[model samples]
Target: MDWAEVGTLVALLAAGALLSGFLAGLLGIGGGAVTVPVLFQVLTTLDVAAETRMQIAIGTSLALIIPTSIRSLRAHLAKGAVDTVLLRQWIVTVPLGAMLGGAVANLLPSDVLEAIFAAIALVLGLRMLIGKLPFLLGRDLPGRVGRTVAGLVIGGLSAIMGIGGGVLNNTFMTLYGRTMHQAVATSAGVGVLIAVPGVVPFVVGGWGRPDLPPFSLGNVSLAALAILIPLSMPTVKLGATLAHRLTRRQLEIGFGLFLLTVSVRFIASAL
Candidate 1:
C-alpha cells in the first residue's frame, strides 16, 4: 500500500478506535453503529467493491466488538450490574442464532440485506425516540416469558445484522426492569451470542465472494479489527467509569442522537 493509503487506513483505525471506545461507554452500545458506517465509507473511497464491503464491514465491526464487549462487561461487572443467570441462557442460544443468521445473510442478495438493515435502522431510530419517554424508563412488565421472547428476537437480530445486540438487549432489559447500569452490563454479554456463531457463517458463506478484502475471515474483514480491539479494551473501562458520573438523561440524549444519525445513514445507504 502507498503511504497515502497507509495514512488513510491509520486515520480510519484511529477514528474507529476512538469512536468505539467513546460510544461504547456513552451509549451502552457495542460500537458497530460507528465502525460499520465509517468502514463502509472509507472502504468505498478506497475503491473496495460493494460485493464484499458490507460483509467485511459487519465482520470487522463485530471482531472489534468481541474485545470491546469484554472490556465494557468488566466495567459493568465492577458496578454490580451483570446478571449471570440471564447471561447463561443466552450462551445456549446465541451461538446457534448467530451462525444461522450469518448463513442466511450470505444466501440473500445485497438488496435483501440492505432492505433488512434499513428496516432495522428505522425501528431502532423509533425505539431510540420512544425509549426516552418517562414512561419507558424504569417501567416494569412482570413476566419471564416476555424477557425470554425478547431474548430470542434480540439475539436473532444481532446475528443477522452482525451487531453485538447490546442496544436491543439494553433497551429490552431496561423495559423489563433492569436499571440502566444493569442493562448496560447485561447487554455486554449479548456479544458472545453474536460474535461466535455469527462469525462462523460469515466466513463459510463469503469464501469465494468476488473482490473480497485482504486477510478476511469469511465476510468479516480483518483490517480494522487489528487496531480496534486493543484500543477499545481499556477505553471501555473509561466509558463505564464516565457513565457513573453522567446523569441518565444526559447519556440517553447522547445515545438517542447517535442512533438517529446511524439510522439515517443506513436508510440512505439502502435507498
Candidate 2:
C-alpha cells in the first residue's frame, strides 16, 4: 500500500479502536459492533474479494475481541459488578454456540450476513430505546437449561455478527431483574467465552484460502489485529471508569443510540 493509503488506514483504525475500546469497557461489548463494520469499510478499499470480505471482517473482529474482552472483564471485575455464577453457567454452551455460528457464517453470503447484522442491531436498538422489552418467562434469570439456551443463542448470533455477547447478555440480564451494572459486568464474561472458542472456527473455516487480504492468517487479518489490540487495550479502563459514573438510564440511552448508528451503517453496506 502507498503511504497515503497507509496513513488513512491508520487514522481510521485508530479512531475506531479508541471508541470501540471505551464502549467495550462501558457496555461489556467486545467492540465488534463498531469494529466489524468499520473494518469492512477499510477492507473494501483494499484488494480483498467481495466473497470473502464478510468472513475476513467477522474473523478479524473476533480476533480483535480477545484482548478487548479480557481488559473489559478485568475492569468489571474490579468494580464487583459481575455475576460469577451466571458466567460459570454460560461458559460452555456459549463457546459451543460460537463455534457453530462461525461454521454457519462461512456458508452464507456477505450481503446476507450484513443484512442479518443490521436487522438484529435495529431491533436491539429499538428495544433499548423503548426502555422496556419484556422477558415474559420470569423476572429472574433462568435455571441451568434456560441459561444454556440463552448462552447458545447469544453466542451463535454474536459469532455471526462478529460481536461480543455483551449486547444480548446485558439486555437479557437486565430483563431478568438484574441491575444494569451487574448485567454489563457479567456480559464481559460472556465476551470472554464467545471470543475464545469463537475465533477458532473462523480461522479453521478460512484456512488455505487464496484470495485473503495481505498479512492474513485464515480469515484473521494480522495487520488489523496488530493495530487494534494495542490501541484498544489501554482505553478499556477509561471506559470502565466512565461506565460506573453514568446512571443506568443514561447508559441505556447511549448504548441504544450507538446500536442505531451501527445498524444504519450495516444496512447501508448491504444496500
Predicted model with the maximum lDDT:
2
Work out the TM-score per prediction.
0.87, 0.94
- Relative to the true structure, how large is the alpha-carbon lDDT of every model? 0.71, 0.86
Q: Which parts of model 2 have CA positions greater than 4 angstroms off?
A: 132-137, 248-251
Candidate 2 lDDT tens digits, 1-271: 8999989988998988998898899888998988887888888888679888888999999998888989899988988889999888877899999999988988898789878888988987887787756554467998888888999999999999899988788778877888878888888889989988888887888889888887888989999988898999889998888888976566678778988998998777666
Candidate 1 structure quality by residue, lDDT tens digits, 149-236: 6666776677667678877877777766667777777777777557766777777777876678777767777766777777767677
Which residue pairs show backbone clashes in model 1?
99-197, 203-218
User: Looking at candidate 2, what is the lDDT of residue 43?
Assistant: 86
TM-score of 1: 0.87
